[model samples]
Target: MNPNEELCLCFHVTQRKVANYLRIENPRSASQLSDCYGAGTGCGWCRPFLKKMFDAHRAGITEADFPTSSDYAKSRSEYVKKGGGTPPPGATPVEDLPN
Candidate 1:
């Protein structure tokens, strides 16, 4: 994922922001990331990614190992199908999101 890409689309939180939060806060679990500007709270679209980041952070990984853009798109599609709000303008399209 692009660092500037919106990981939590509802809150417009970017991958860089989440990574920074992880480095600063040293949260023990993915849920704790919600405290960072309500990252995984809204719509829950970013939960999986949050967990991935959290696990990576706990493992002392400094490099980003984000899921493919298509994975994000598939997640976003399911989120919207379940009544979550639409992704912001310039967000990745659903066709790109699905597996």
Candidate 2:
């Protein structure tokens, strides 16, 4: 995924923003990313990506380690199957969320 691309669609948060947040705030866990303009709080599609980025950042990995957009979609599908995130109202099927 492009660093400037919208990672959290609902919040319009970008991967760069998340990266910067991680670098500056040094959140202890992935969930702490929510403090950064609620990056992983809405829709939940970006939660897995957020975690991946957070882990990579902590491990001193470069942004090149970030997963592709397709990978993020696939992982997010599995995450939804595992009941990892909360879908907002009217978000039936849980596969897609409102913009």
Candidate 3:
């Protein structure tokens, strides 16, 4: 996802926000990312990406591996359709998706 794209769609947490949080907050583990605006706590789609970012930080890499925003949102919509997760009330709807 792009820096401005919503990585955690359920809570509207952007990739930039998570990246900054990972850098500034210096969380000890991937799970600690939840404290950064309820990121992966909702539909759970972004958990892997969050973990990926954390792992990269620990490895001293500043870059992250992520799908394009469209691909990510499309996958998320598919996941939702398959009942992989249910987004919270304030989350971006599966049908309406991404900002």
Name the best candidate (by lDDT): 3
Go through the candidates in order and give each one's C-alpha lDDT. 0.77, 0.74, 0.90
* TM-score result, candidate 1: 0.73
Structure candidate 1, residue pairs in collision = 73-97, 74-97
lDDT of 2 by residue, 1-99 (tens): 888866775577788899899889898998999998878776687777788898898899867355686666556656666777765543323345433
True-structure RMSD, every candidate: 4.0, 4.9, 3.3
Candidate 2 Cα outliers beyond 4 Å, as residue runs: 64-99
Query: Per-residue alpha-carbon lDDT of model 1 for 1-99, expressed as tens digits?
Result: 888878887677888899999999888778999988778766677888889888888988866576776677676888787777655554445453333
Q: 2 or 3: which has the higher lDDT? A: 3
| Model with the higher TM-score, candidate 2 or 3 | 3
- Candidate 2, clashing residue pairs? none
TM-score of each: 0.73, 0.67, 0.92
At residue 83, what lDDT does model 2 achieve? Answer: 76
